[model samples]
Target chain A: MIILSPLGWLGRSTLYFLAATGRITLFALQAFSHIFRPPWYPRELFNALMQIGWLSLPVVGMTALFTGGALALQIYSGGSRFNAEAVVPQIVAIGMVRELGPVMAGLMIAARVTSSIAAEIATMKVTEQIDALVTLSTDPMKYLVAPRVLAALLTVPVLVGVGDIIGIAGGYTVAVQSLGFNPAAYLQNTVDFLEPLDIISSLAKGAAFGVIAAMMGCYFGMASGRGAMGVGRATKDSVETAAVLILAANFALTGVFFSL
Target chain B: MIRMENVTKSFGQKHVLRGLDLEIPRGTSMVIIGGSGTGKSVALKCVLGLIQPDSGKILVDGKDARGGDRDAFLARFGMLFQGGALFDSLPVWQNVAFRLLRGRLKRPQAEAREIAVDKLRRVGLTPDVADLLPAELSGGMQKRVGLARAIAADPEIIFFDEPTTGLDPIMSGVINDLIREIVVEMGATAMTITHDMTSVRAIADNVAMLHDGVIQWTGPVADMDASGDPYLEQFIHGRAEGPIEAVR
Candidate 1:
């Protein structure tokens, strides 16, 4: 094999990155295009919703609750240094709604749903089930990718909304039970401080992250090479790509929503 | 009828098919025989539109196979994969009726199930196995299910990819006979790619040998034994020494 110089290696890496990006963008566009087409399968969409949204509640909920509880304690201690421990409710609500809730939910989904989707599709490919689908005159994009992507796009934002509520409740429970904060006052403070934009931004982040997670899975899956090793690599790569893209998407969505 | 002219395909630098030409007439069974990795499957996939040729013309019934309404084109054909590629998620009957239960051929749920059971019966599967998933079936059983699925849509053409690859000797013979009977009964154009010489003899109306990315020999199955093409003779008689290279 010819050894590449540093510049050559860098150039090769750049080309690979661009090619991967182009493939993902096109796959996402095709998936979205099939969403509005006729001959839609409601059973598939519902199954996807159940798998991606409802089944994900336990993990996303537990993450939010624990994070919210921990945040309450940390902020209280940090605020005590300034004699402002009473700011716990407002800070916790804003924190979960503005950033932590959506980001954490997205990451959890990237890990769970993305890996699952990639492995399933890649395995189907290895067994030639995808080709069987084509032979049966069914479009794999519409049957596989479209339902999952559309379901994630619609349901993830709702999961974010649920996560936000659960997270705030966790903060409330910890404050009222352990920190001696008045329950009614804490609730009122949380409600008063959280603007609609905070919720909107959180949901928007969820939608963007959902699309990234799903599209990454489909792209890596369809682009998988061959064999058992290929399926494993596709699963690993999909989760990595989904997680990284979810975080990057979170940052961009945050900028769009919160930066002034 | 299906015809291919000057078909060429390569993945990166490794060329597979090179200026290959083939013609398959209507209502005949064509089996392409080649050594492992000799692009026999690739050739079948190219005609099935599962893969595109780098440069070629593939015509079916006087129309170009590619760049058409894909669903309409695909609906006219059925394929049984090498590994039996049954959907692990669906029961045996559902897998058999996969093409009929959805898409433009959507049948009512009960009607689809009935058709699936009927196909399963035709494939010699018992009614008890209809609700069992593919993982629950034996390899021979899975192949039968796959064969059932291949005939489900009753398409004008059928492609079988290595249909006897993983079966036992007796099972392979059984499957070979079943395939022969099905082709005879359906009167559908059939294309099969395999390395098994017994399978070649059993299911082929016509035989073609692919070596070095081109058709080395083509003739009626009876003529295959005495075609006098060295490549064909070496391959059919199972000689260690041959014109075709055994390894890359």
Candidate 2:
């Protein structure tokens, strides 16, 4: 329902946003608490691990490889403008391990896993499976949400590490094969340029982004309305929300790790 | 026994359940009948603690039904959902054995599967069907599987929501007969909500007619035809010219 006055409209919109934030925060807290409690379902957790982690590797790997190749080319050309083409290995290595690697992996999973989780859960709600779960003495948060969120939190960081290596390899292949760079020199420069902190921060961002993605999916799914349209809306909204949150989280994570 | 007193629930401006009261005796089958959107499901959900009425005192066996350990409270009840609501990812046996395989009621895997198979046979399903997913079964088979799951735990109280909503006439009759046999044989307390008169006749020991968010009429099923309440008559006869407007 809309109000006639602009002030009223603004107030209503603000209140709605605040209420939504409160609900999402409450759901996230409930999931966190349930995860620590007993009556755990190891089977559901293993299923989630395979779905969210192992199944996501191919897409994450391909995206990182192409991105790494493109980034190497762009950095080489840009550096040549300043007579600094020799900086290709250093810049590509740092750019990938520091930023692009985790962000890309997170965004990719957010698109794939988040949307699928949301749609499936929303459909279950529509079909009364969630209520059925409740009636069967099973909590939806424990059976459905905890496993998924925990699996994502554990797996996305590993995916990010794999993506980082593949991406760097792609850059190395491109540089040594086509850019007229020494294969040994390129590998040496890349090896010498990376530090442990860079990789650690990348994975830290991965973990944070993973939590955002899976949590958003479960929240939107559980809160979905009725009917087919409702399930569709939840799916669409989950991806959009997860993508936005991942980017915002990436920015905050970067500031925390590299601001100094 | 289940007793609901002065239950009132509202969603926005629409009052789905307004000051509704009902009493169902133990080991008796009570079926609530109403037109669509007349709060039948809402009332049932309230009793299950699936929906909380804005104000009400629901007593299950003389104890207040609200404010207790939810899992412990829910353990006493089983429900057959309108759409079957079986987990697509789970095999039929696992779905039926869900309660037995986990939580406070956990049974050994082999024992649980044995129970699930027995229940499936009781519902006219062959053991061969137990390994199939819900999606693999026909609608009637799915409904049978759901019924088996509902009674698998031997719950003292069972609820059926629109048990025959989307089935062919013969299948519906089969389900109705099966439900009647289960309730009579087990002597379990049963509450069902349905507009299907065939289902009502086959399943109800007592009948309650809901209209305008209240029980317009209620009595033993044998007296339903001569109840003399206009609302009940209008609904049972499916008359569009009665007090209820065709347009909401």
Candidate 3:
């Protein structure tokens, strides 16, 4: 009888919304639960590795190299006001490994892998392949998400390591040829500034970034709506979420490593 | 054997399935016929556990289909999707043997490939086609490959969702014949959804017409001719002016 009142109606609507959200959260939890079960797909993991790791190297490498070169030039010009141009190589090396390398690698991967995974899985969901997998005694999360997550965790660090090397090489190239720094001295300064902590932090960031990228892709993909527009929306949402989460994760990791 | 008792499914304010009930006997082929959006596909998906009904009980071999060990239950079934749903990144053989090569039922690569090739051959495809990607195959060939993959594990039950949707008439006929032959040879319980009367005639032992989320008529394939229900009559005769309206 109280349903007649305006406050009661608003309360009812709020409760309904909460119930809907609870159902969605339960759905997402069920998906995550499948990650630890048996029937792990090694072949799918291999395929994901090929897709997420090996193929991603060139693009991530290219992006890092360009950013590193630009960073080196900027640092050289900025340091000139204090007659401190010699600081260019060290600052560029630290900047690449500490920030630009991982962030850029993460963003590039979010752009590349998230859209592809989301679109592919969304199409599969739409076309009933996910259903087919379910009817075949297979859990789609285990068969789909786990393998990609594993590959991303194992491979993105390797991608970041490669990116780090390329970026430093980029900085060195510009410092030696364009900034009038000697090759031996630039390499020495880079080596001196890059402590093991920097390397470990960079790798840790890579692993976190990888999980964020792949999770967003799988999450949005499995939850996509119907039709072409639905798939397109899922793809866009996956990329955007992956990118934002990567930067956020990078910030947290950085804070943990240095700020505290 | 499969049975759906008082299945009711609704999305928001729209009712898709309303108090529907159906039964399928073991080792028989049942073709469900209806217009596009009449919930035939939804009914199939519900049986397969891909969609959950608001109220219903689906049983397989007298056991609840929604019970525990769902993986074991699903393992006995295979499905051929409407669009083939082939993995583009993998070769044809790998796609066929996807189930066999993954999970607890995994086979060695060599054995998986061999089985894939054998299944392909069973569907009237050659071994040379195994290495090619799905994108390289024609639509009919892709359907054949999908058929091969469906039967790869020699499942006891199979479901086909518009298996001949995109192919030419000749290709459709070939797929229809292949499905009929495979179902008969394996003695597998089969369920197929299609609006194509030719397919129903060619592949069905029994025909069930779904309209307004309920079975309007169901009988032996021969009895479908004399069903006499105006909806069935119009549907089978492909008439324009009947109870059933075109989407337009």
Provide TM-scores for the models.
0.97, 0.98, 0.90
Model 1, residue B245: distance off in Å is 2.2
> Which residue pairs collide, candidate 2?
none
Q: Which model scores highest in DockQ?
A: 2
| Off by more than 4 A, model 1 | A1-4
Clashes of each: 0, 0, 0
For model 1, the TM-score of its B chain against the native B chain is: 0.98
lDDT of 1 by residue, B26-133 (tens): 999999999888899899999888899999899999999997798899988988899999988888888998888888888998888898888888888898999999
lDDT of 3 by residue, B22-141 (tens): 889999999999888889989998987888899989999999988978767878888998999787777999889988887657789899999999999999999999999999999999
Which of candidates 1 and 3 reaches a greater TM-score? 1
Return the TM-scores of chain A for each candidate in numbered order: 0.97, 0.96, 0.89
Give every prediction's interface RMSD: 0.9, 0.7, 1.6
| Candidate 2, position B126, lDDT | 93
lDDT of 3: 0.89
Candidate 2 has what TM-score? 0.98
A140-193 per-residue lDDT for model 3 (tens digits): 888888888778888998899899999999988888888788999889888988
Stretches of candidate 3 off by over 4 Å are: A1-36, B104-112
Candidate 2 lDDT by residue in tens digits, A24-79: 99999999898899789999999999999999999999999999999889999999
Better of 2 and 3 by TM-score: 2
